[model samples]
Target: MRNPLADKVVNIKPSGIRKFFDVVSEMQDAISLGVGEPDFDTPWHIRDEGIYSLEKGRTFYTSNAGLKDLKIEICNYLNRSQGIDYHYNNEVIVTVGGSEAIDIALRAMIDGGEEVLIPQPSYVSYEPCTILANAVPVIIELKAENEFRLMPEELLEAITEKTKILILPFPNNPTGAIMEREDLEKIAKIVIEKDLFVISDEIYAELTYKEKHISIASLPGMKERTILINGFSKAYAMTGWRLGYACGPKEIMEQMIKIHQFAIMCAPTTSQYAAVEALKNGDADVAQMREAYNQRRRYLLHSFKEMGVECFEPFGAFYVFPSIKEFGMTSEEFANRFLQEEKVAVVPGTAFGDCGEGFLRISYAYSLENLKVAIGRLKNFVDKLRKEQGR
Candidate 1:
């Protein structure tokens, strides 16, 4: 019997993060920092709104672009917080999550064989989404010296006549590297010079530490060329709610909305209601969670230094990328052995991209007590390895 799956579907690998998660799941007493979700529960008020909506029988599909109220709230939220604005009536399309928004945007923008430039050690979705959309994902390896930030020179070097989009995964996953206004301006100049479109994933926009996140779309002349992706998952502690949105020029948004409409019908209606309340009243919860994660970030950095693990200091997001090169093991080998010896699960850096080899991503989303325990186990594991190798 012939397998009926499309060639593109068969060619892509499963998400590297999920593969390790499944392994960790079977291990009893494993402390996992591999999954990128907040430890905090969704705030009570947001949950209440969802319950309130369900009780009022708001279960049917929403308008394909989502409810006007939610879109309006999203527009206001982005404008006020990130200084990026979109027309609620024409520019925003709410989707199942940022994941869906990425998929829809790629499908809408890329024709077959078009090229999408993606910076490495980024979230895993960008490359696969581009491939699934029949676009070539041109991977640009970001350097650790620049704190894994995408350099304009690197970006310019990757551009070709076939290039149609650039996936800006800043305030990045795994590395936690963010591009500030100056950093973005360099890239923006190239975008304008080269006539490239941008899919800016700002899912971690609220979690930046050193400086407030600057949306690429907020730069002069870039709004029309950028698709901004954000959601309540990280900011509002609403990962399970599966709500996200994409905003861009009306023409691009209209095309994305078509893909979303045929594929998802609409994002969950209850989630849309909850998202409205989140956008309106969830600022305090976001601030509280950011402070908590920051504390954990500080603790983890201190512990890693004490343990002699060389790491790039992360200025954003809740994850730390530490080089395990001195340990004389591949990222996967270190991760597997660390799990076996210490029962603590951190993601192998290679799971993010090829450039992530010799590093590990430790998420600070756990409680302080758990982090202390994990660090203690990590200390022991490092010591044992040192003793065995006579280091």
Candidate 2:
């Protein structure tokens, strides 16, 4: 019998984050800081809305584009939250999650062998999704010195004639790097000059510590050329809901919706009703949660300082990437050793991208008590390594 798997699907690597998560699950006393999920429950009101919808027998499938009410709420939320305007009818698409939104957007826009510029240490899905879309994924290694923000020069250097899309993963996963307004302005200029489009994944938008998350779509000349992907998973603690949306040019959105129509039918009808509630009444809840995450974020930074571990301060997202290079171990080795020695699980930075070597991603999503214990273990691990190296 002949093997029948497509090589493209066969070649995709399983997510590295999940590999360690599976390992940690078997350890009885292990404390996991590896998963990027928020620890908070869905806000009571949002959950209540879902219950109300189900109780009212609103379980039917929504339109392929999702509920119009939800789309309107999404547009209003984006405009109110980010100063960007989008038409609910034509410019926005509701999908299974930000993940599906990403998949559809790439499928809609990418042609065979088109080049997509992806900055390293980003969300793990982008590269694989691009490959499945039949596009070539070109990784630009962002640096620790720039706080992992993509330099315009780097963008320019990577662009070739085949370049068609850029995946902007800011308030980045693992590293927690955020691109500021001015930083985006620089890259926006390059994108316009080069006639490139962008897929901006701002799923971590509301989790910024001291800064407001800036969307590249809000920049001049960008609204028409950017596909902005966001959802409730991060901000509203609705990961299980699997709801997200994409807003962008009508032409592109039409293509995305076509793919979504055949592929998804629509996002969950129950989830859409609940999301409308999230957008309408969940702002205060988001603020409260953000403040809580901010406290945890600061504590992690201070703890790293006290331990003398070298890591750049992260202002956005729920994870921090700390360098383990001083210990003279590969990230995987350090993480495995830490888990064995301390029963604390952290994702090796290589999980994000190859450039993430010598780093580890520690999520602050756990409670302060759990994090404190985890950090105590981590400090001990690092200190022992220090002693061994005489550093």
Candidate 3:
């Protein structure tokens, strides 16, 4: 038989997070902090909305863009929360998930070999998506000193004539870093001057703890150049619903919808209806969950400090990136030994990018009880390492 796999598809690496998750699954008594999934179940009202939609025989496919009501709610939510005004009719498309939105946005924008600037230690999907889109994925390695936020100098340094889009993943996964309004204003100016577009993945937008989440699309001259991606997964704990949306200028949105139309037909109809409820009545639920996650975040930071482990305080999302560089082991080695010895599972920071080599990503989405148990184990593990090295 001939070699059937496209080299591009064959060569893209699988998710390192999922590989560890599979291992942890088979081991008895393992507590996993590898996945970024919210531990909360979908709020009852949102679930009821999906049930109601199904009972009402609303299983038919929506327009390629999505149900009119869901798109309207998405627009209203963005406008109300971030001062981002988008026309639902021409500027929005519901997607299977934010993952799909990311993929399709790249596909639509890249002609053949345009350079896509992706900040490091971001979600694992962006690099593979850019490769699949036949674009050059230029990774801009973010530094821990910058709170893992993309610096304007870094962006300016990576640009060239081929540079086309920037994948700005904020309230970031794994690192939990958030770019503030002033930081974004400085980058936006550079983007405009350089004539580049941005794919802003704000999937964890509502999980911000220290500051209100700001969308770059709401910035002057950015509404037209930014593709805003978000969904109900993190904030509303609707991960399994597999629903997300993208909003941008009409020109880009039209092409995105075109791809979505043929490729997906439409996002799940019931999920769209449920998401409308999420947007309309889910603010309280989001706030409640955010509070819980914040409490856990603080707990983790305190525990890390008490144990003398180095970790930056994360103010957004549910994950914390703790430096394991002092342990004299790579992130993967520390994580593996920790899991085997302590029965705890964490993702190596390098899963997101090579620059993440000396850190580990730990999610605090678990309950307070679970977090305490995990921290206890982590403390013990750190002690063992230090003692063995005669520290």
Candidate 4:
């Protein structure tokens, strides 16, 4: 018998972040700070809308794109929040989640063998999706000294004639980095000069602590060249609802919609309805959750400082990347030993990218009580290691 499998699928690696999560799932008394998910319940208003949709027997497929109302609301939400305007008819597409949007957008754009510029220490999906799209992945390693922001020089260094798209994962996962307007202005100039396109993943846009998120699409001439992807999962605690949307140039979006139509038909009907309510009336709930996350972010930073851990302050998202280089152990070694001895599970930073070695990604999306306990365990582990080094 001949073995049958697509080599591309087999060659792609599974997500490294999930390795620790799978173990912690069944381990007794294990506390996990590895998953980057919001702990809050879906806002009641949004949930109630879903219930109402079901009661009304709205259990059918929306159009191949999405319900007109949801798309309109998405446009309105963008316009009011970011000063960008999109046409609901042609510029938006609802997806299963932001992950799906990432996948399909790559499929829509790549024609095989083109290079996609991906900055390192990002969400795990970008590289694999580019590979599955038959495009080459070019990684631009981000630096901690620059607060993990992508610099203009780095972008210029990575580009080649084959370079087609840049995946901008801001309010970045694992590292919790954000690219400000100034940073983006520099990048946009480079992108335009190079005739490159972008896929900007803004899933964590609403959770920033220091300043409002500035969409690159909102920049001059950028809206025509960027596929802006976002969803309700992080902001409204709607991950289970499985809803997200993409907005971009109509030509690109039309191709994305063609892919989505055959592959997915449409996003979940109930989720779409719920997301409409979220977009309209969920700002207060989002603000409340953001404040809670901000508090946790501050607590974790202070605890790391007092414990002598060298962690740069992260002003966005719910995770921190702290250096463990002084411990004389690889990230995987330290994280594994800490989990085994202290029963606290944190992700090795190398899970994000090779450049993340000698660091750990600790998420603060858990409750304050859980965080306090986990940090206490981390402090104990660090002190024990320092004593062993005779420091």
Model 2, 217-282: lDDT tens digits are 999899999999999999999999999999999999989989998888889989999999999999
Candidate 2 residue spans exceeding 4 A from truth = none
- Clash number for each model: 0, 0, 0, 0
Give me the displacement of residue 195 in model 1, in angstroms. 0.4
lDDT of each: 0.92, 0.93, 0.93, 0.94
- 1-391: candidate 3 lDDT, tens digit per residue: 9998899999988999998899999999999988888899999999999999999999998889999999999989999999988898999999999999999999999989899999999899999999999999999999999889899999999999999999999989889999999999999999999999999999999999999999999999999999999987888998899999999999999899888988899999999999989999999999999999999999899999999988887889999999999989998899999999999999999999999999999999898998899999998999999999999
- The C-alpha TM-scores of every prediction are 0.98, 0.99, 0.99, 0.99
Q: Give RMSD (Å) of candidate 4 vs. truth.
A: 0.7
Q: Once model 4 is optimally superposed onto the true structure by TM-score, how far is the C-alpha of residue 226 displaced, in angstroms?
A: 0.3
Clashes of 2: 0
Please, what are the lDDT tens digits per residue for candidate 4 over residues 296-367? Answer: 999998998998899999988889999999999999999999999999999998888899999999998899
| Cα-based lDDT at residue 243, candidate 3 | 93
Candidate 4 residue spans exceeding 4 A from truth: none
Candidate 2 positional error at 45, Å: 0.9
Clashing pairs in 3: none
The candidate 3 region of ten consecutive residues with least summed lDDT is: 308-317
